[model samples]
Target: MEIRPIVTDEDHAAALREIDRLWGVEPGTPGGDRFDVLVTLVQAYEERRWPMPKLDPVEHIIGHMDLTGRTQADLAKLLGSRSRASEVLNRKRALTVEMIHKLQSEWGIPAELLIRPYKLDAA
Candidate 1:
């Protein structure tokens, strides 16, 4: 197997295709080594080409709510009262450290995402 540094988009694409072809190869085999190297190269290319953004806390929460079909009342149970949930969702109130912990633990949301500053439109 001729392994090369993933320097260009073409190289990255070829590496990806090779990885797909070599996937599920037995460990300690030549194909497995090729799979491992191709995966690393693809990761390096992706990290350089596309960076992930830190999501805003409120927006993240709202997105979760939408995805789960949850409402302010549901968040209130996880947070506190209905008004407090509304306030937090509205951006009038910032999430407390305790609330962040609870959200991370209960809703499986990342605390870092929950702690970012976000604006809420005035009702």
Candidate 2:
């Protein structure tokens, strides 16, 4: 059980191979223990090497609308104004608390997602 930190890509590859060899081993045994540690190390290395980008609130809203077959006009109805919906979608305005509440209540969009700070268009 000569496990090492996954530093370089070569090290990562080696750990993966070892993990494959140790796969399906009985838990609480030597091989299974090694497998667990290696998997954790590999996961950490992958996260650092290829971190995921945070979801943009507007993009999430658009994606949700697409998935649910909702349109901009539908969003306007929810927001009480077509111009306000356009402004929010176009990054011309930030989502207000009332807008967030409406989205959460009516559209099931999570408030936390909508609350995240996002870039706005320069004036």
Model 2 Cα lDDT, one tens digit per residue, 21-47: 988999999888889999999999999
Q: Report, for every candidate in turn, its global Cα lDDT versus the true structure.
A: 0.85, 0.92
Q: lDDT: which candidate is best?
A: 2
For candidate 2, what is the lDDT?
Answer: 0.92
| TM-score list, all predictions | 0.75, 0.59
Top-TM-score structure, candidate number: 1
Model 1, position 33, has a per-residue lDDT of 81
**By summed lDDT, which 10 consecutive residues of candidate 2 come out lowest?**
1-10
Model 1 poorest ten-residue lDDT run: 114-123
Instruction: Write model 1 residue lDDT over 59-120, tens digit each, in one string.
Output: 89999889888888989999879889988988888899988998899888888787766776
Clashing pairs in 2: none
